[model samples]
Target: MTSSSKTLGEFFDSFECEAFRLETLDDYSKSGNVDAYHAFLAGQPQPSDYNAGWVEELRSHTRAGKRVHRVHILSRPLTDYLSFELGWGYRKNSTGGEEFFILDITDKPNPLAGVPDFWCFDSASVVVMNYDETGKYVGSALLEPERVVEFTGYRDTALAEAEPFVEWWAKYGT
Candidate 1:
């Protein structure tokens, strides 16, 4: 399918080399997994099947030697959602070989300020993620080819300034 006709989900299926995501929000409580998030808040044990579908998808990509990774831009004293995400989501996802990075800007200024969350596929297709203030999934926009270069640079900067999640978690994860 042509880029014009391709959706963000389709890009995940079609990318040949790597998929990079830049996460800027701290709270995605309204986006998905509401039940799980609520359970986490109640101090319940995480279900073994939590996030299973996404874990399987990550395995499909990483097992083929394709990279599916992301850098989450966040600050210290993580929000409840961030805690749940890193504590549960990222930890489980990593078991499937998906890589994670942390861009902690607790003291330093945000390097990619004002940039919306997005996913860049194979450094070719850029899809801008739109979310409501409450972090609900609004929709996504697939940018034209000309905007790919800009998003690629954003990805590069984020990766360069971010620390591997393991190290960050070792020092800061609670």
Candidate 2:
């Protein structure tokens, strides 16, 4: 397995029996072209079982006092599809006294080909992203946000670009 996968596996294993809340795109329900945006905003029941293992793992980590945040970027078409079919929205989990945020990155324009960058999760005080020498997303790193910001000026850009997602999350996510 790749090192990233191994690291994630190790993290999960560390909290095997802990209890944490589950939040993901899968947590939302989907129908035809109408994502139950209202339902999601209202915190309705989950309608599907996809990503169950991932959900469990997240819950476990949070239970073990680890903050868990995730981001998924979708193509515009897929984003529309999700918006229409499922009530995909943002949701926050307060576990272990930590808040985890999730956002959809499909709408934002991609950075330049050689722009090295990272995302800083403020709640966790952790920076995570995949970067390469060519400025491509090649691997994920877990580090301090200040380091990423000081090194790449990515934090401000990320926060600005993420505003829409954050707004949507606040409105639609539980």
Candidate 3:
């Protein structure tokens, strides 16, 4: 299918080699996995099935030698939502061979300031993820082919400024 006709979900299936996600928001509690987020806040142990479906999907791609990874731009003194996402979501997702990174801008200046969240598929297609003020996922916009270069640059910059999640978590994870 042409990239224009494919939804953001379809890009997940259609990407041949790699997928890269950039997460700028500090809280996405309202976007998904609300129950789990609530349980986390209650100090309850994470459920065994937490993020099971997404983990499996990551495995499917990774086992096939496809790569899926993301860099989250964040700072020290992480928000509650970030604590759950990184401590639970990211840690679990790693088991499926999905990679994670942290662009800790706590002390350093944000190089890609004002850049929105987006995904680049195989470095060919770009989809910008939109979220409301409260971190509710509003929608996504699939950019034209000409914009691929720009998004890829953003991805590269994030990766360049970020450190591996494992290492970052060890030092600063709550």
Candidate 4:
């Protein structure tokens, strides 16, 4: 696409084949679900409609033979927000055919150290996620085409050291 017309929304709408995300934060409580996170902290049950929009979007993509998956690099003793994200968000998002994996670096060095979180679409385009220290979503930067090789390497290395979320959660879920 031309620089004049490039947009994240357009990228999401146009990408084919697959979408991969890397999440390395312990808490994204301030991103989009402020109320839901508070409810989780306050002992409220997860609302049925939580994340309905994203779920439907995933369904639309997967239903069309596209893949949406993520690898979350996290450790044991998960934070409360991580708990909500895994037990509720991941679990619910799976219903729409999104895949989750966990790269537990609790006992070892991070192989993908210093790599910022990003989403690589169809192995071609990459949009790097930008966040504040408090885990707030600031914005995303679309990298130049020449840098896809670097991001693809990160994705491959992450997947190599990760396990499916269902299996890992079963063995170590809080």
- Measured with C-alpha atoms, the lDDT of residue 106 in candidate 1 is 100
Per-residue error (Å), model 1, residue 76: 1.0
Off by over 4 Å in 1: 1-3
TM-score, candidate 3, is 0.97
1-174: candidate 2 lDDT, tens digit per residue: 123333434434543332222122321223221334555445666456533445565566665665543333333334433453223322322222333333344555543223333333333222243533433435455554345345334433333344344555555533
Top-lDDT candidate index: 1
lDDT of each: 0.93, 0.38, 0.92, 0.91
Query: Looking at model 1, which ten-residue stretch has the lowest summed lDDT?
Result: 1-10
Using all chains and alpha carbons, the TM-scores for the candidates as numbered come to 0.97, 0.37, 0.97, 0.95
lDDT for residue 133 in candidate 2, whole number 0-100: 42
Off by over 4 Å in 4: 1-4
**Clashes in model 1: which pairs?**
none
- Per residue, candidate 3 scores C-alpha lDDT tens digits across 81-108 of 9999999999999989999999999998
Over 76-147, each residue of candidate 4 has an lDDT whose tens digit, in order, gives: 889999999998899999999999999999999999888998999999999888899998998888888899
Q: For model 1, what is the C-alpha lDDT against the true structure?
A: 0.93
Candidate 1 lDDT over 37-134, as tens digits, reads 99999999999999999999999998899999999999999999999999999999999999999999999999999999999999988899899878
In TM-score terms, candidate 1 sits at 0.97
Deviating ranges (above 4 Å) for candidate 2 = 1-8, 11-47, 71-156, 164-166, 169-174
User: Comparing 1 and 2 by lDDT, which wins?
Assistant: 1
